[model samples]
Target chain A: MSAQPNPTLSVALEHVEELARGLGESGDALALRERARDLVTPLVLPDRARHLWRYTNPERFVPVADPTVLAPVAIAHEWPREDDLAAAALIAGGALRMVEIDDTARRAGVVIEDLHRAATDGLLGSLVPPEHGFAEAINTAAWHGGVLVRVPAGVELEHPIRVRCVASAEPVSVPRVLVVAGAGSAFELVEGHVGGGVPALVLGVTEIAVGPDARVRYSLVQRWDAGVTGHLTARARLERGAHFQMSLASFGGSLYKADVGAVLAGEGAQAEMFGVSMGGEKQHMDHHTEHLHEARKTHSNLDFKVALTGAARSAYTGMIRIAHDAGGSEAYQVNRNLLLSEDARAESIPELEILTDDVRCSHGATVAPLDEEQVFYLKSRGLPHFQAMRLIVYGFLGQTLQRLPATTRERIEALVASRLHEE
Target chain B: MTDSTNAVFSCADVHIWVGEKEVVKGVDLTVMPGEIHAIMGPNGSGKSTLANGLMGHPLYTVEGRLTLAGEDVSALSADEKARKGMFLAFQYPVAIPGVTVASFLRAAVSARRGAEVPIRDFRKELLARMADLDMDTAFAGRYLNDGFSGGEKKRVEILQMLMLQPRFALLDETDSGLDIDALKVVSKGINAASTPEVGMVLVTHYQRLLNYVRPHVVHVFMDGRIVRSGGPELALELEERGYDWLEPAAAAGGA
Candidate 1:
């Protein structure tokens, strides 16, 4: 295990094969997993100074392998009411337990199926970048089961599709999901990640595809337990005239690192990404955002914010890359960090690689203690110390929170406010 | 006379320092109930410094004593002084993005009262205050002071003063940047808050705001000292004669 490279850490092919054997899958998935493991073995591990794993060690996310068939644990989850959802998926112990679709969506030719069957039919690993990263490669080789949602062309779904994933398997749980938005269709997805307590790891990945003229909104809210180590990747590809809006909010996990990105694959594609992260206690969080412009006349905007209290720390990296032939593209990125305690720390790095002419690209990053003047202003209004700081933090996160579904926004706001008091 | 214990608010030999500079060199002031004391000064005369220091801004180190309604408040924080009936309308209010004016005022009002204000009463009063200042009620829903015009920011400060209803109000250049129409409305809001139980101190460089909200006494403040104190006509005198007449006296440390 110690001889393994840093990229895949100690997770070798034996671990991958062990998990695959437990899944009891045959043929096609076998070929993909084998191919993924081979791709990982010979590849050079990414250096922290080079990219990605600067603040976190990848080995911490690689848990001990149970090497047995995944059986469900007695963990509990409260999913949104069926009436409020176009469809819902439940994944437990690295296997899809249920996929429920509304009659309206069924009539509109929307398809929601188990990821195992989709991969059996060779649908897995199609949209996620093949050379995504080392952790993603391990996920590709060892991921057991999840869900896939396909919205047919020209169909507009009124309700959001919700996916709930729980890490019931001991030590390590790898969950994956795929989403397809057909041409001229409108799709909204909300993913809720929970479970996995002390001494557990949940390596999750989600891939999204937006067809031409499709409009999609994807929101992933992560609430892993305090002792869990999480490595997550979620990325999307946009076609011609497609619009994608994503909200990523992180609140829990002992140590977590996430890679969220989008590739503009067609002309006139637009992606608007927003992030809200608050860390407390001894938690450590690292986030990386990527926007790749592969087509002309594309546009992308990103705003990611972090606030930390206690001895918590966070690192944020934002990258905007415009391909050589991709002209007339516009990209903007902004990152803000607020430190509530003297011991809390934050680091922000913004990188932009513009290769073409006639493109507009700008990036900004700011790190500061909560504005003293603002806190004093709120305090002078008669609020006590904690209430004043709470109000400031609330307002700081309010912009991105306003972009979320009202109910979810309220829930997260309450959770964040309560956590502020706790700290 | 201020030692009589009947004064609404008073500060004795108060000196304020912003780092190495002593902006407000030892000064004494007293405000009787319902009486407005106008501290008129030039741009750098430290009038704002005095107001902010009296309100206990942490950046300014204050020496001497401050009493609000006969309760010593020199050791209290800004919020503590607020709950004890003190408020300062800033010369330049800071922008707090994403905090709506309505919600900010609600929290402040609740803090002042030491309890949450009822929603019905809060909304009703907020709208009423906004209307009194010639501000659209929609303004309450906007982020506080974010991208607000100069006049709008001044008006919101006065609106907040009205909402908090502090016993000792410090209007620090609250009249600056306000046009005649806005000046009139803001002055009206100030006058409405000046009751027998309240004392007011108006800090400004110009007398235009005095036309609508008359001050009972005017102090010619220069070089951090009060060079002259007199009746309301003192403001007119300073406006007509300018401040150079008393420059020597102020620079010499006192009237």
Candidate 2:
């Protein structure tokens, strides 16, 4: 519980005060700002000694005291349109630039709007409590114009909703999102983060609520420039008989840290999480995930794969916790890492805590270099060295990537291939 | 087979070392076009080492000369040699979990031809070859060697040989784990690919494989060197009498 003093935290705290003063008399907004202030006071910045932050250095991120410092930048809106099932929202420089929902979805009572306005409507702040961590606290306090998405009860969207966030050349940017799936609603979401190589810092938070019997599939792809430092945090809750599926891919960023957690709070709830991360050329990427089964008959499964090369480093930690009352629950977790070069390094840790004898929990982890036999076999068939390596790396990651929605999976695969082939 | 005039594949005074230990001692071998030379030996007699060493596996330190079509390729890499019209059917084909068999063969075929093959033509050719080998068409969509049975893995290897049409090929224990039916199917594929311009060297530990695919010459490999060399009858004779009789002679020759 020792407080770790961080310049970035102090700067963020000061910025929160300025933002709170600007709110004036908006009751819910003012109340949320006050709660954020309270949460920031005793907040202890995590250090390398903390298990979750052991592989990530928080000092690398420089905080922005003034939200106005980031000038809005235009983002290209090129997207595939064959399915006509996609809705998109674009945010740039901490501001919502554009939001688009298909006519069918809009007519079905799906709400996609600015979080600042959503706050006044009493639809923000509850899903992501301010007391989560330093990153969450700062995001809750400093996010300028985040996006909020809500699908009404009994509505099922045919296609996915895409959210794209572009950070400007500014030294720091905070992006926030909140998603709510009403009871019996079904939808999918794809969130992407990208920016120019301007040595910036991005702090992002996403909160999701899956109502009873709702089905939601969410994916996040982080492809920031090599000069960016990204810290992304996410929390999700599942109601009775709800199904929540999530996938994450990290292919860029000089230093990236992601913390994601899911809570199965009702009977018969299920969660499946899959992730793939590739790091190269002095990059450091860390991912941490948690599954909390708080009710009986809850099920959770997590599989994460990572590949590192060229002096890059990565760390993955997954934990499954089954409460004493969560009898008949089943949880499985696996983390696999492949090191493509001698200088590359990776560490995987999978842990489990089951408080009930009737519950089933298992975890496994593996870290190793590329299999020489497989490479030789590919080469023996006339493939050049680089092609052989590429095929093997794709094969290694395809296990998790194949589980993603087809279009999203292909898009991420192309991004990963381009990043891997970068000189 | 020692007639260097028309020999498509030749190895002279080659020694292979894995780390500091020599796995293949000084050896000389030559295979003329249209001839199948079978190298028979007891278990752990360095048959695989010789095959891999000739194929220029990176793990082994090789000395002396390996030639194909009168060009010295002693320093060429595996892929480089493969592109130069040489192929090796691995004893244990490694599984590539996500790359489909069709994609891998297409790449290999393109590399061999130095150009891309049209999809329709490639599919037609692939399906025809697969049918000839009694392989199911569904395997083309499956991951290369991933979750494949032993017989299926061997069949895929021969299929690659047929598709690439290498001038010289080496089969390393390709018949080891296959049953009678699978062995015949694999052997048929190998025989069909053996043209007058292609030379082959099949390495095996038993004579069961030689029954399906006939070999013009048989060489008994003991330890790391060839202890005996003769016609096809040599394989049958060794099958009747185990390799124990040749151990003393091979040791004496080495000393």
Candidate 3:
């Protein structure tokens, strides 16, 4: 793509450059800044013509003026104790505020620190290539608050680590996370987003690397307020005998787009992706996911469910691609959507591209309203209409939630129940 | 028939319509507190439609008066009617995936009593009911009617009837798809639920179920109206002959 001289995009790009300049040049940070400068010119804004941007408009999330000029607002730490999360880190006002790691995890060689410091140590920007998409490019260039988590070899943490990013009236917040699970390591990570109901733009990305024989469970919960527009992207690479599972629960944001992809890059690698999204009251949520099988004896499974009410809308597209040399690979994808209101709508698309005939691959997608028979069944059992609908929706989304850890599942169930009541 | 004042469930000139087409013509029936009334009909004779309409299905427009224990309930929704001690066992029980049978039963029982039952008491009651129905305790954790066999669904429906203790129950084609063993098990559950305080209306196509749970009153339904009324011998006579023998009389009556 050639560079375009659009005034609005130019202003945003210049602001990103100015933010990069302020971070100071040091080791990997300097190299990343230079790369970001070169990439901004060719990174054109996405439009509806592209399938990835078909359901959303990128220009709406791009700030017209210099975002760096806005002053930071103080934000309080309000993590819920009921979640029982092991460790947590906070990012607010475009900076890393605090990080808390459990003593056991710290003693077991688990490292959780600022991404800039990791970048200075030449430990950033290697997993996620900068040229993948506009969001990634912008995040690489102007990321304000970022974190890196590394679990050394043979270390198994019993509790889940949570990283929360809250936007406190910032015009633009670019948050990033990089996770590396060393060989034979096992752990779980939970990433969350919360907004202050300001008309801000958030561009975020998370990169994961699961080493040989490592197992990782990662979840991303997006709960931005209705005033924010968010674009979140994630990518993961799994080595030999590595098992990785990732889930996303999206309940907030006026305009949200998420692209999460995983690649089984070595033999015996396994990956599973599951998600549940509830959209209501004129909200727009677009989700696209991919599973890439690049080695023999690799397996992947994906299941996503969405429930829409009021005038909300959602679009989901899933792709499974198997390389030519990847034989004995098994892949499955299923997407189901429930429309709870006449005005609510959803679209599901499941695609598969298999280059070899020696693989088992299947995909299915469905968009349907709440079954009247099921609703009447509940009503006949003395449940009111709203309660009947709620039960059915919870049942529909529970298929995905049941796959998470017990604590995570309970927390998400509570979040989803509250969201349903609010609508 | 007993006095109308003592009737637990009563209906008068009830007509059910789906859109503009009336499915159940004008019909009148009444059942005392300890009575079982069986309504036998041919296919497409509006047996199930009548049962659903009487339960206040939103799709059908029900006209005329319906009463439960001498109170007018003609305008109540299905849930409201259910809370007021009315229940309908569906012909085709819907499979609600991810909702455990135990949880659904608990919610229904709670709604009926207007208070949440303590977990210990609820579990005890559920286990006792399941044992009575010969159902495995593990079935309680499974999704409500999801992937359950035909007999299992009917048994669960009866289990709900026993748990909720509705004053009146309507069973619609509950015996349609079942083997002899399953039918007997389901019939045992139904018989166990038939107490003196709870009246019942069984809508069926066959008299086989009546042999297990004999009814005090039998009504022959045709073309959405009751063509004839008699006692238990009527079911045996219809079984000996056939519903074809009554079509002529029904047609003349309609004219």
* lDDT by residue for model 1 (A42-144), tens: 5445665655777777667655563233555655555556347888889876678788888999999888887766632354776664467766777787777
The runs of at least 3 residues in candidate 1 whose Cα sits more than 4 Å from the true structure, single-residue gaps closed, are A1-9, A15-26, A42-44, A66-83, A119-121, B251-255
For TM-score, the strongest prediction is 3
True contacts reproduced, candidate 2? 0.78
Cα shift from native, residue B160, model 3 (Å): 0.9
Best of the candidates, DockQ: 3
DockQ-sorted candidate list, best first: 3, 2, 1
Error of 1 at A282 (Å): 2.5
TM-score of chain B of 3: 0.97
Whole-model alpha-carbon lDDT for candidate 2: 0.85
Sorted on lDDT, best first, the list reads 3, 2, 1
lDDT (tens digit, per residue) of candidate 3 on A126-204: 6566777766776777777888889899998888988888866777888888888899999899888987556878888
Using TM-score, rank the candidates from best to worst. 3, 2, 1
Q: How much lDDT does each candidate structure score?
A: 0.84, 0.85, 0.85
TM-score of chain A of 3: 0.94
Error of 3 at B190 (Å): 1.9
What TM-score, over all chains together, does every model reach?
A: 0.93, 0.95, 0.96
Provide the DockQ value for model 3.
0.80
